[model samples]
Every structure is written in C-alpha cells, then in structure tokens.
Target: MIRKGSQILMEVLQEEGVETIFGYPGGVVIDIYDQLAKTDIRHILVRHEQGAVHAADGYARASGKVGVCLVTSGPGATNTVTGIASAYMDSIPLVVITGQVPTHLIGNDAFQEVDIVGITRPCTKHNYLVSSTAELARTVKEAFYLARSGRPGPVLVDIPKDVSNSEAEYRQLKDVKLKSYNPTYQPNIKQLRKVVELIRSAERPVVFAGGGVILSQASQELTEFARKTQIPVTTSLMGLGAFPGSDPLWLGMLGMHGTYRANMSIGACDLLVSIGVRFDDRVTGKTDVFAAQAKIVHIDIDPTSIRKNIPVAIPVVGDCKISLSQLNRLIDEIDLTDVPRKRQDWLGQIERWKGTNPLAYKQCDLIKPQFVVEKLYELTRGEAIITTEVGQNQMWAAQYYHFDRPGHFITSGGLGCMGFGLPAAIGAQVACPDKLVVDIAGDASIQMNIQEMATAVENCLPVKIVILNNNYLGMVRQWQELFYDKRYACTYMNHSPNFVKLAEAYGAVGLKATKPQEVESVLAEGLSLPQPVIMEFEVDKEENVYPMVPAGAPITEMLLA
Candidate 1:
C-alpha cells in the first residue's frame, strides 16, 4: 500500500509500541505533526525542545523503554543538545527525530536547517539524514534498534521536509540486522569462575554496583549474590536503587559525597567486584590511589569502558544481568560455609565507620534541605518515584531518601544537568500515572526548566515538585566558600521568582514552608493533592553537602561535615 512519509513515520512508531512522544511542531515538521495528530499516539507539547528530550529521557528511565521525541529544524534541534548529551552520558535509550529542509537544499544554508546529524555526531550513539521517503521506515527502525541496543544511548534521525510529503510503499521492517553491532549477552565462564574464586578467597570483598545493574535489570541477582556471599555492597550515585538501601549489607552510596563507610570500604577492601560502572572521576577520586588496595574485577557490556578509566585485574565483557546470573550460579557451587566468618572483621570495621560518622544534619530553626528530604521520604514511605535536578538538592535526595527498588530514584548523574527534575517528573508521571512521582529540585535548578510546570498542568499529571529554595546555586556557593576563602562569586541568585505564585500562575497548586515545622505539613498537603503542585521550602542558604573529597585527593581522605 502507498503511504506518505509522515504516515509511515506514525505507523512505524505505533508498530514499535510508542504510545507517547514528547515533541513540538514547527514549519518543517508540519506534515509529520498533522499525521501524528491523526494517530492514537499521545504527543506532549513541551515549552522547549530541551524539556521534550528530558521528558522523554525520564519516561525511558521510568518505563525501561526507548524514549521518543521530535522537534523542528535549526534552533529547535540545537536546543535539544544539552538533554541529548545528558542522555548520552547516562546511557539512556532515546530516539530523537528532527525535521529538516528539503534534500535539494541540503548544503545551501537553507532556512530552519542546520547539519543536525553533524552537530550530534559526538554525543549520539548513531545518527542519519533521510533523503528519500523509501528509506524512512527502515531508518526509523534502525534508529530505534540502535537507541535500545548495546550500551543504550540517544540516536537521532533527521527527516527532510520533502520526504514527509513524498509517497512510497510502506512495509514494516521486522528483522534489523546491523553487521557491525552485536552485544555480548553471555559472560565467559572462565571469568565468572575467576570472580567466584576471588569471592571465596578474599577476606574483604565489596560488590560495587553501578547504573548498569539497574539498566540491565540485575538487581535481583545482585541482591541474591551479595546476600549469599555476605559481601557488603556500595553503589554509585546512578546505582542508588540497584540493591535494597535498607539492607544491612548495603554501604550506602560511594563517591565524593558518599557515606563514610562506603568510601572507607572501597579504599580498604582487598577485592573490588565492580559490575556495570564506568568509574567516573566523581566516583574514583584519584586514579592512582582509587581502590588501590583492591584487585578489581570489572564487568560491563561495553568492552571499551572496562579499562578506559581504571585498570582491571579481570575484565568481563557481557550484559550485567547475564554476568551476575552466571556469578550467582558459580557461587552456589563453591564451599560457602565460612563466608560469613571471613567477612566478620570487615563488616565490623564498616559498622564502626558507620557509627563514627553517619549521615546526619542538625535540626535548626531554619529549614534544612536534608530534613525536608527526610520528611518527604517518610511521608511517601520511600515509595514515590523521586527525580532530582543537579547540585545540593540531588546530593541531599541521594543521601536522605532511601530507595529500596530500581527506577525509584532518577537524576542526571553523569551530566549533572540542571533543570532536569520537573520535566522528568512529568514524563515519569505520564509513564506511570498511578504512581506518585516527585521532582526534588533546588531553587536555582528548578528555574532552569520551570516552564514545564505548564506541561504538567495541561496533561493533568499529578507530579509534585519539592523545591529546596536555598536562594543560590548551592553547590557552587559551597565550593566557593570552602576553597576560595569566602570570595563569593556570581553564585548568589539574589532575585528569583515567587515559586508559589509561579505554580499558581501555571494552573497548579502552590504551597510554601518557611519554618522547619511547616515542612511536614506542606509535604503532606502537597502529596495529598490530586493536581500538579510546587511545594517550596525556604531552606538554609549556606548549608553544604559534606564528606567531601577535594579534587585529586584520595577517596579515603575526606573533609568531614
């Protein structure tokens, strides 16, 4: 059957089970938008292109599916760069389609046309510029395939305007075979055996899990393995919910703002079994001294990431779930009667470290950001899907809110992008309408994409925005205070909008808490509301996130709070 390119695009999206897309229409994408309107797929009209991509990213993270977003050419396409980079850094699967000028005007500096494919090359996993309607369906299929496969990341497809208006016979591409790409799902048994041997012999072994554990859905296997081996576990920021936070074996998060026990354990452990982590600079404070005492066994689907940052004693290239499953089976075969006894001294040391400097903040007259996060966690019973913007708010949420399951906590861990939480919350809410979704945002970060409040209001999404209004770029200000000797830079956000009025103006409920006592009531009321809300708490402006490891310092050397 003959079909227009736009029609084929819509049909292929539906075929791929894309029920919702976050996008905006412009001159170049009018035909596509027109066809999209005729279909059953829900389109979220975001105020900005960045918001659209962030929303899609949030949706993908929450739903564990390839997120889809569309935008017009030139500036509209350029605006999505930050969000795309964020997704790329975090390895989020996303298919971003951008409209373009006709094929004839390809290199003539056409209006509403920029070389999007070229612009996004460095960040995107792959990209394409479709010149003909005949290849539209295939390109889309390949884009979706590339986006979701092998260390998932964003893939862009630029569709020329004429192609959408052109006609071609439509046929759904079922089998997509890319000769160059094939992900190893099965782990090498010898390496698994080696890991098991290490587990058996090492007196102090720590299972350091990362976002890849959650991405590969290996939380169950990880939990079981850690429990059976009696190995304490510590996670990267992105790996927050990969293991149960409330578990006795959990060592909380490990990094610059990581817990005292977690960092100390990583520094002192004899064996470090790293699963699905990139070993970013934030996690590994000094390359030379990071996990210096430990023999590292690194397992990741992306072979390039194995030895890219830190040298590994054992590099296992395979999917995280598969590798963990194999390790679990191998572990079951070993003599494990003495595992608990072997780990007793190590666990005792960790307990002492935990007791010595546990995560704590004083309850003062002024509202404390940590206290607000604690109350939110309590009120929601740690059940709410918590998304966070970058900076102090992100750190506080990570420290205070205990996540017991995967996908419960979402944040821009790698890119550390500001203005991510609110739109992400909207996307998460849309993906899971029945679940309570909250964006734990900072006052400054929240304003970055605050326009998305209208998106939530229009969609009737009951996402709650908890703004820790510290009235400054809290993270940077903290650094300036500590390192620069109180040379207060341009970090102060002297003028900001009245958040309550801002929410009300966007047709959503607005609440504020000035005193520390009002924090609980505001949270409770905001959570109880059926509509979208922005609950702002005027928090301590100069408050800082502690357990700091100065740049280039060893992870063990920390400036305590």
Candidate 2:
C-alpha cells in the first residue's frame, strides 16, 4: 500500500510489536513524532537524548526485548554514543532510530546534520542511512533484525527528513535474511563431546558464566548442568542472575570486586568451563595468570570472543543455551555417578574459600553502603528489580543484593558508564509496572542524569532511587587513595546539592538517612511510597570495595579491607 515514509515507519514499528519507544523530538524527526502521536505505540519523551538510548537499553536488559529509541540530528544523535557504546560493550540489543537532513544535504555541513551512522560505526553492531522512501521499510526491518539476532548489539537507522515526508510502498517483512550474516547456533558435536569429557575427567572443575547465558536464556540449562555435574559456579558481573545467587553451588561473582571464593576457585580449578564470557580485563585481571591451572573450555556465540583473550583447549562457538543443552544431553550418556565424588573435595576447598570473610564491613556510626544495599535487598525480599549507576555503588549492589532469576539485576557492566541507574530504573518500571524498581546509585553518578527524575514523575513510574551519598566520586577517590598517594584531584563532590530537596522539587517523594539506625527506616519508607522516590543515604566516605584485584595484578592477588 502507498504511504508516507513516516507512516510506513510507524507501521513497521507496529509490525515489529514495539509497544513503547523512548525518544525526543527535533526538526528532522518532527514527521515521525507527528505520526507517533497519532498512533498507540507509546512514546516516552525523555529530557535528554542520552536518556532515550539509556532507557531503551534498560528496557532491553530488563524485558529481554530489543530496546528502541528515536532522536534527531547532530547533538541529539551524538548524545546517544555513550549509551550505544555501553550497549555494544555489554552486548545488549537495541534499535536506535535517528532523523537526518534531506538526502541532498549529505556531507554539506548542513545545520543540525551529522553523519551519525558513520560516527556510531565503531560502536553499533550495524547501521543504515535510508536515502530513499522506497528503502525505508526494509532498512527498519533490517535494523530490528540485526539488533535482536545472535550476539546482540545496537543498530542504527537514520531516516532523512524528506524521505519520511515522501511517499513509499510499505510492506511488512515477516522475516529478514542477511545473506552474509549468519551466526552459528549449534556447537560442533566434536567440540561438545570434548567439553563433556573434560568435565567428566577434571577433579576440580568450575563454570564461569557471563551475560551470554542470560542473553540466550540458558540459565535453566546452566543451573541443570552445574547441579548434575556437582560443579561450583561463578559469574562475571554481567552474568549475575544467570545462576541462582542463593544456590549452594553459587560462588558469587568472579574478578575484581568479586567474592573471595569465586576468584580463588577460578584460580585453583583444574578445568574451567567458560560460557558466554568475553574475558574482559576487569574479569580476567592478569590474563597470563588467569585460570593458569585449568584446561579452559570456552563456549560462546561469537567466534571472535573465544580465543581473543585467553587460549582455550576446546572452543565451542554456538548459542549458550543450545551449547549447554547439547552438553547436557551428551553428559546423560556418560556414567555421571562418579562426577560427584570426583569434584567433592574441590567443593570442600571452595567452601573454605567462602569461609574466608566472603564480604564484611565494620559496623560504625556512619552508614556503610554495603549495609544499605543489604537492607534494601532485605526490604525488597530480593524481588525488586535493581539497576545501578557505575562505580562503588555498582560494585556494592552486585555484591550485597542477591539475584535468583535473570533480568532482575541491570547495570552497565562492560562500559561502566555513570548515570545509567536512574533512566534504567525508569525503563524497568515502565516495562514491569507491578515490580518495585530501584536504582542504587553513587552520589556523583546519580547527578549525571538526575534530570530524568522529572520523566519518572511525569510518567508516574514510581521508580525508587537509593543514592549512596558519600559527598565524593567514591570509586575514583578509592583508586586515588590506594594507588596514587591519595592525590585526591577532581574526585570530591563535597559541594553536592541536597538530593532530598532536589527530589521534592521534581514533585517526587524524597527521604534521607544520615545515621546507621535510619537506614532501615529510610529504605522501608521510601519503598512504601507509591510514587517515584529518591532516598539519599549518607554513607562512610572512605569505605572502599574490598577483595580488590589491583589493575594488571593476578586475579588471585587481592587487597581485602
């Protein structure tokens, strides 16, 4: 049927089953906005362009769906880079739509025009610039297809102003096929058998899982495989919630700021079965010494990620869930009874590591951030969907709050971007209205996108914010204190604004907890309210995240506080 490009775009979005879109309007995107207003596809008008992308990213992470965002040319599109890069690093699926100048203005230094597709080329998995109305529908289809497919990442579609205003024949594409872009979903049978053999033979084996396990919905298979084999499990930060945190086999997160037992288990295990992990520097610490004693078996959807960081004895390239499923089936054929006896002593040693002060903070008059997180987790009964801003607060939330299911804990793990928590909480609240959504934020990181408080208030999202107010950029300060002779350069935020007053000004509920005793009451009251609330907790300023593997140090080497 014949339609305007804007109408066709909306039709395509509806066809893709996009119930909501986060975006802002500008000159180039006015046509799409006009059409958007007339349709039922919910559009969240964010205060900033960056928040639009971050919100979409959050929705994707929380709901396991492809997040969608829209913005205009120049600065609007440029502002999405950080969020885009964050999604790219974390492998979150997102489809970011931006409007551009008319086709003739390409590369002419036109006002409000920038080559966003070119700029985001390095960050996005793929991008497209729709030059003609005829190509608009297909480009939109390709964008969503590429965004949600294997090894998911953000994809951008730049529609020019004239193209959206022009006429086009629209057709809903039931399927999108990229001839050159096929991802292997099934692991090679030989490789799968080798992995099973290694698991059966090793005396001490450990499973290291990452975001891919969650991305592929392989948590159940992961749990089953671990339980059946009687092997302890550890997770990278992004891999939290992929395995039940309360599970007896759980070793907590592994790497810098991870549990003592998890790091030590990975260090000492004879066989390391790594799934969906990228082996990033934060997780691997010193790569040469990482899993030195283990015969590593790396399984991932992306082939490039397999041997890129650390050498592996067996590399299985396939979907995490599918690969795990294959291994489980193959494992069924083996004499699995001996596996438990073989790894029993290994689990005992891990228990000893767990006994080594897993995580603790001295009780004092001031509120410790870990204590606050624990109380929050307790008050929520581990049910609240938790998002976090970057740095110490992020680490503390990961450590103290336990997640038993996938999609419960959301954070910018790979990019470690500040200002992610607030918008992410809003997105999660929007996606799951009945769930209590909280952003555990650092004082400095919270301020970065504090403007989104208005968006939450306007939408009546009832998203809660728990700011660990130490009056400093806590994480950077800790590094300075530890590594740089306490230089304390630009890390302090002692002059920060009153968060309670700021929350009130935004027409949202605000509360404060200055003493340790007030932490429980503050969390309960803040969570009790039905509206968007910001609860600021004054925490110990000098407290640092412990069990730290100093950058470039072996993962086994730690500085415990």
Which number leads on lDDT? 1
What range of 10 consecutive residues in model 2 has the weakest lDDT sum? Answer: 336-345
Model 1 ranges off by over 4 Å? none
Going through the candidates in the order shown, the clash numbers are: 0, 0
lDDT values for all models: 0.94, 0.93
Poorest lDDT segment (10 consecutive residues) of candidate 1: 546-555
TM-score, prediction 1: 0.99
Report the lDDT of model 1 for residue 32: 97
For candidate 1, the lDDT comes to 0.94
Q: Taking the tens digit of each residue's C-alpha lDDT, what string does model 2 give over 402-458?
A: 999999899999999999999988888888989999999999999899999999999
* TM per candidate: 0.99, 0.99
Error of 2 at 259 (Å): 1.0
